[model samples]
Target: MTDRNRRFLLKARPNGMPKTSDFALVEEALPDLQPGQFLIRNHYASLDPAIRGWLDDAPSYMPPVALGDPVRASTVGVVAESKAEGFKAGDWVMGLNAIEEYSMAQAGGFSQLIDIGNVSSPTHFLSVMGAVGLTAYFGVTEILKPEAGQTMLVSGAAGAVGSLVGQLGKQAGCRVIGIAGGPAKCARLTDDYGFDAAIDYRGKSAEALSDEIGAAAPKGIDLVFENVGGIGLDATLLHLNRFARVALCGLISEYNSEHYGARNLWQLIVHSATVRGFLISEFLDRFAEGAAAMAKLVGEGRLRFDEHIEEGIDNALPAFLRLFEGSNQGKMILKLI
Candidate 1:
């Protein structure tokens, strides 16, 4: 094992989209583990849109990552040493391990031992069986409540969460329409993920998108599982059916911008539609139930997921930036091992 720990620390708060220079990679000697603490050799770390929100010095679901601190991220690792009860060496675990080659933590925090017996790849814990799946499951099954024969639309439909959202909508018997950036992603949405139709929002105007949405869902959308929250959302709003529901999951389109507001919000009133924003953490108490259901779907071959992996801790910052640039094809993970 290496004697030093490699980590990326936040150097500056981002103004818009995060730049690689906003972070600095540093190496430090690993410390001795204390009683009740376990040492982890992190193998993989998740890159997510929520990490962008954590960089800003503003009120949010969690505290911001302080300058000079290791940037916060969820990671999967194997326990190399442990003094904690119920956790032993060689056990695979998941936690808020940040971006580092090593992490030391107590049992009471976000760390939890995970079973990888049934999974083909442990990385699925960061994709289909992890937070991405939980978000998609709760957002659609509990919040959006899409019905059979109804029409459901998902923005960022080719993403890790959005792809699952579209599939879940289909499983619920809804006619699913996806909105993604490129022709290939849009094609994958319909051909691969089972979306009934797809809209390529690459260079289309909002008016053009609205027309496309109208053509796709002529009966109007019954549920909008939103991820991108800019022009696509505005266009989607224009085509909402009466009493429609929208699960406002994430706003990746506006994550980097200062002026981030959606037009056509008035359409909510016109259509008597309901929009509710949620954090996956809010449903933590029932995470087991949701995770179990998602696992069952994966086990039954009813759910599909994808990951875009960047090898090594050295590539962590670049991998993270891909989330904003829309270059990542699926869930982005930094493979440190």
Candidate 2:
């Protein structure tokens, strides 16, 4: 093992959008391993939109990232050393390993072993078998419960969570419409992910988008996988059919802003709609079911996934910002090794 560990440290609190300047890289000596402890070499770190929420000092579902902490990140790694029972050297695992070259993880903190026999790659532990896939599964099955032949719309459609949600909607026999930023993303949603229709948000304004979505779902929308708040939510609200259900996932559009102005929620009352916010953490026990279903679909060619990987850990900040800029085409990940 190396004498010094290299890791990304949270240097300062972000006021708006976080930049590379907000983080600092530091080298420190590794501490002696205690009982029931293990050391790991990180391979890939998952960059998620929810990380922005973790940077703020607010009361949320999870605690904020403390100053000088190794900027919390979910990573897949191989164990290098262990003093813990049931774990040994060369064991591949997934856990909250922080953004570091090496980390000492407590035995009980994390130990989700990767089943490479079924999955295509290790990073699937962070995408299809991780929180992203579970978020999509629960958001579609429990919240939306879309009926066959009904129409469903998804915002942030090409993203990790939204892309899976669109596929699950299709599997349920719903006509799925995806809203992404560019033609490339839109095309991938339709051609690769099996979405029924794709709307390029960058090509037209929100007002102009209303007609396109309306034409696609002429009977009005039965379900909305809301990954973006603000204007996207407003547009979906305008087309919600009576008894329409909306699963409110992450709101990427409003994450960096100081104030996210309210939209016309009265449309919900007029249309008799229901919107519910969800977090995957609340349904952790059901992860096995979600993973099994996703794996089965993938094995049958009924569902597909893509990863937009940026090489090296140094590219994390730039790659993460791509979510807001509409630059990433699929699940964005940073290869740390």
Candidate 3:
């Protein structure tokens, strides 16, 4: 491949919140693929809050997107050229691809092939059919162990994982309450997503938020699927029923903070509540199972998922900022030709 590759790079580590200066866009000629390698033309990229942790230099489940390296993201695209025996050109696949117009991968790096035959769009993989679905599925069933009639509250309910988690909770016969920023997102959660209740965190104080959540779950919350931590978790901790399960999915609030206060963790011990942190990578062995179950639910019209896509790789920084601003209603993706 002699084509020029357009890409985005992590120019600098962010101190608290990322700015446009943290990234730099560049163009380079693509290198020829070796035998057993394939060239991919990336079309869609997943923009996740977890990517913020990947920008730091600290050790994590995966290393930070290295300085000057194309930002790491899950992407869907078609194989333009292939030398591997199992893969042929024109196959549609999704996996860990850099945020760029084109990516070259050795055979081992590519995961399962995606069947886009009856799916709505390729971008679905970045949301319902991809890692987001797996994260929500496992987090709800395995981690939370939610029972029918139990009450479930999800922070960041408008996000990719949280939205699905809340819907699955409702499907399981639980009363679902969503916590999201702003009235618009709160309204979307209750009206559009079938949540039993939605609370606007921007308007309510932490104490008032706890009271509202408490009123929603009069019997006390059986499960809390947490995405944004810090204050939200602190407020919710005051209302946990005995033996409640809290799935720590992502700490978007604290992810970018230098230091965050947690003043209410003692309530966990008081209530015998259990909180477990989960990384989707740990459930990778069961990804196929999770994906199949989520797909079946979606195919059967038992689930509804959404994606907010921003066109062009050049807008990646601003697009990513949407996650923190609560500007996106679902899985956020970047489109690059």
Q: Which candidate achieves the best lDDT against the true structure? A: 1
The digit string of per-residue lDDT tens for model 3 on 1-337 reads 4489998988999889998888899999888878998888888999998889999999889978889999998889988899877778899889897899998876778445788996889998889878899999999989998889899999999888888999999989999999998888888898778999998888667788888888877888889999988777889999999999999888888877864666888988999989999888888788889988998999898888888989998889989999998898678999986
Residues 1-337, model 2: lDDT tens digits: 6767888888888878888789988888988888999888888888888888888898888799999998788898888889987678888888876888888887767566676667778888888778788888888898898789999999999988999999999989999999988788888899889999999877576688888888888899999999987777787788999988889897888889964654768988998999899888778778889888877877887778888888876777888888788788677888988
On a 0 to 1 TM-score scale, where does candidate 3 land against the true structure?
A: 0.97
Pairs that clash in candidate 1: none
lDDT of 1 by residue, 278-302 (tens): 9899898888898899999988989
- Candidate 2: count of backbone clashes, pairs at least 3 residues apart or interchain: 0
Model 1 Cα shift for residue 76 (angstroms): 0.5
> If ranked by lDDT, best first, what sequence of candidates would result?
1, 3, 2
Name the regions of candidate 2 deviating beyond 4 angstroms: none
List where candidate 3 sits over 4 angstroms from the true fold.
Answer: none
Instruction: Show where candidate 1 strays beyond 4 Å.
Output: none
lDDT of model 1 at position 17:
79
Cα-lDDT of candidate 3: 0.87
TM-score per model over all chains: 0.98, 0.96, 0.97
